[model samples]
Target: MENYPTEIQEAVKIMYEMRGNSEGMMTWKNFPLAKQIITLLDSIPNRSEHHTPYDKIFILNFIIDNISSSDTPRFTIEIMEKELALLKEVLPADLEEYNDPLTAEDIEEELQMWRDYIDTEHFSNEEWCRKYSHYMKFDPIERSEIWEEKYYEIESKIDAELMKEDMPRGLGFCFAYWSSKHKVLAEMGIEWQSPQEMNPGVVFD
Candidate 1:
């Protein structure tokens, strides 16, 4: 809360109170989708208040709008596809600037970590999973029938339950929102890539 900017802080403050608590409870859940986003946007540390930069605002707004919206169901496939594209489009591009070849071992480790990424974290979920997959790989078959079914099944369990309108989901997911938050340890200059949990069916090479 202390890290938040003034305007965003104001909005969150109002919303917090509106929901009857600082934690913004709804239906026995933690801060509701609208409140979560309101808190997140409000938390952005910026020069001014609600007037955050375009990219930042765009990112947050995209997340807030969709997550809390009841409209995605109207055209779940189309909306999911579009949101997936938008997420990839907006993801930070700094990772590709790696200094050297990503060796087979490196690939293997990354793949495992990617799989481990499925482990539920603070705020991350399927939406974050799909979006991250989109940005980290090339020509990913995100629209596969399997993915479609998975998305349908997952989305069916959600509706207007996001923290914000449609900014994004998984804000708390191991640094899903902040690119530098819970960085991959190996990539952060701490250690070499390590193998992920062993699975015979999975191969890095």
Candidate 2:
């Protein structure tokens, strides 16, 4: 098996931590089987340079989901091996040959667009408090709705600019994973501000 890339190795380590901390695995007796399956997955060739970490994250989540399904351990290492083999059969021999239309430049552009929009947009005091107040004080569902509305607004702008008929599967997954405003801002190396931080003199009810 090929040595795992640094990012993939890190992802595997995170998966191990998740497995150890999982509440459902307290009495599970299949640590060895889980380890074997994860090791096998760690060796799988990454499908894309930019999407490898996301792919590994997806695989780790799949493993955990399956492992947590039963305390008795429904699947064996051999079964996993067969499944991996079948998966490999459908993969391209040189996955690098496939190019993702969405580049890092594109991501950076979208991130900047989001940042600028957030920085310039004005909201009423009540709406601002609902959107940016601390989680405990304000309704989280309302905050989510505001963020969702903003997210779609930005996404529509991006779609119009790109004008691509179909987004690649891996990029689609990546976008889905980082759907929230905080996550998107973090990706852009920006920190989200609280209501108090953004409006020092303003008081919230």
Candidate 3:
């Protein structure tokens, strides 16, 4: 993989943690896989109030597409296959049939719902905040910006690893577009680069 190891471990962890329990090798295909997975890893909360059934599926697909598994300590290919199958089962027929991708407002609303749910269990929304008491006092925007700065720095590590595959945005928008599709992360104004972070100055943008 060119950037960020391009595996799905993060997705697995996110999905598993979403239920606040462990599904072992289970994954949902109901929504955008990559996005939800990211939310999970990012410790973003869920909000059924903000999304319809279809939006949930979109979220699954989004996270599944973006998270990597290679990051796991002893993950097996069999586990990956099982998770993939489960994901497929949860997916809606013809995701492309829908247009008008979600907006930042949509993400915020959904995330807020998740926040309300987790608040009873997890004190702070941000992962770092939960880890450290100091971060708990920071405003939402401030915490978001802090993470944005960190992600941007990570981006610099793999800025130049573009491979130019048959990306969803056709090629021109492959780099920046894909990166910005992460609404919460995008709000921080950070660019997406390779997850592995090996090359630099080789992005499509």
Candidate 4:
């Protein structure tokens, strides 16, 4: 696999830490599997505020599709099957039909939401400002420019990755989307075991 950008590495590191790993994994290819597992665990009822009921199932499917198409050595057939089973175990019985495909309109709306939040709520909203008060000390103009640049970089990479799967404009929203999602998942109250936990003795095959 090609080298991942520093921004992606940082995102992956934060996610691993979210799972209680003191040191983030260096292997990038395995990230899709890890991301899928986290989404599955977070989907469980009452697991976390981020729990989207069955919405996580769809996200898992999307991640799996990407993994299947990527030319990476991160996931073996055995590991994939194990992870899928773990995800299925949490599915709610009688899940109502869900067919909300991410459309161009939805992407645009999401992008707008991100932009609005960053430009307004990021520094004005009490909770948001309180949580990120340290960053607030920076010059407003410089800070805004830095954030916009980072968002552009991350979303640009995401756009390229999604393009490879013919999923243009799929997940190129902004930092807010990922940050809120992970913040919610951090509350996954239960001790959700991931596929890596199934074979703790091995790092990766």
Candidate 5:
């Protein structure tokens, strides 16, 4: 554990905590494939500092995407195995060779860029409204209309001066990593919303 970074340690703590909780324990018991993947990642040797938590991040996202809930029947062994095999095949042998390691500063800078980007006249208000409408407490149809109106009203008053405080909170390192990765991809002329397409089992939202 001393060899792992703080982020990786935290992720490992969470996975073990999940296994300890009653609901999570049941979920893990039912979906041993997910547990197996975590175990496999935990066994990787001589992981570089720069590549510290990517493996843990991958495992967490895999669990979220595949294990719908503790009570759901969505955990399918065949599908999990297929996805895992595909991921191993596609993953680069040397991830550090593909890109530099993302840091907290990089995340903050990227998020600030997002704030600036959203302030520009080119920002899509409708898309923003649609993306965050799920957070509204109203009924689905009502929430959509309400959020649309709310966003437009705020947009009109703000006049393209979107601020960082207006952004979502509690996104954690996974999002920060995704944002940094997205910036790198954009510079390379690649357009992808999620890294899952290229790095299977790794998703950000």
Candidate 6:
């Protein structure tokens, strides 16, 4: 790891420690993929002295994505779980830069936004259907009333239903929206604040 950036060196040390042999020897065979990753990180040009949260995210994503590629043996659930758990032990804990310090209020806000997004999209579809309904010469009056009543019924009860049953469904919606938002952030080269428990598969990796 000599001559590598300090951040890369630190990341290498963490990876090595996570896969260290019980006999106190650093064995490359313990984690062949990790070795390749270290090599790749070392080869990066003009590496920075300290890796920002975003940089570390890129490195983590690079390692995971490469290890889970089609050319390689797919990462088993156990391996993926262990790697993520071990990485959490070594990676920096603070993630304010990612704007994902979720709280009860934050979750509520996100959930509301999620609901609004869904509502808007649904209404748009309804509007399109309504426009098409006007062109229907066959029972247009009956059809239009049916569409309007359906929308009204759903709109009236959707919120109550969402917040009903101890709000379990609403909570689910919150997590769903939060997870998707985090995925988008990850794609944008930003670190995710969430632990990504629901995304156990490689699709989210």
What are the lDDT figures for the candidates, one per model?
Answer: 0.35, 0.41, 0.37, 0.38, 0.41, 0.39
Candidate ranking (lDDT, best to worst): 2, 5, 6, 4, 3, 1
**Candidate 2, residue 149: how far the Cα is off, in Å:** 14
Candidate 4 per-residue lDDT, tens place, 1-205, comes to 0253333334345444434421221133334445545544443442233333344444434343433212221232333343344444444441445555433343344333334334543445444446534322222322243433333244345444444555322234323333432333344321223223333564432
Return the TM-score for candidate 6, rounded to 2 decimals: 0.22
Residue-pair clashes per prediction, in order, are 24, 0, 41, 0, 0, 0
Q: Lowest summed-lDDT stretch of 10 residues in model 2?
A: 68-77
Tens-digit lDDT string for candidate 1 (1-205): 5564555555555444434532332212212444455456545543344232333333333333333222122222333333334334332342243344223353344334434333334324345447556333211223233332333333323323233334243434222322221133223332221121212344432
User: Which ranges of candidate 5 are over 4 A from the true structure?
Assistant: 22-54, 65-91, 94-205
Tens digits of lDDT, candidate 6, 1-205? 4765654776666554544431332121224545455555545542254443344444554344333211122222223333344334333443444544323343344333323323433545345346435321221221232333232233224334433533443335655444554554445444434324423442332
Q: Native-vs-model 3 lDDT? A: 0.37
Q: Give a tens-digit lDDT track for model 2, residues 19-102.
A: 664543222323444555567655766455444433543454345454432121123323333343434433443335445422
- Badly placed stretches (over 4 Å) of model 4 are 1-53, 68-70, 73-79, 86-94, 100-205
Instruction: For candidate 5, write residues 25-142 as lDDT tens digits.
Output: 2332324545555555556532564453445445444464544231222223233333344334333553454355333354344333334323325434344345445222212221
- Residue 157 miss distance in model 4 (angstroms): 15
Q: What TM-score goes with each of the models?
A: 0.19, 0.21, 0.19, 0.23, 0.24, 0.22
Q: How many backbone clashes does candidate 5 have?
A: 0
RMSD per prediction, one decimal?
17.7, 19.8, 18.1, 20.6, 19.5, 22.1
Considering summed lDDT, which 10 consecutive residues are worst modelled in model 6?
68-77
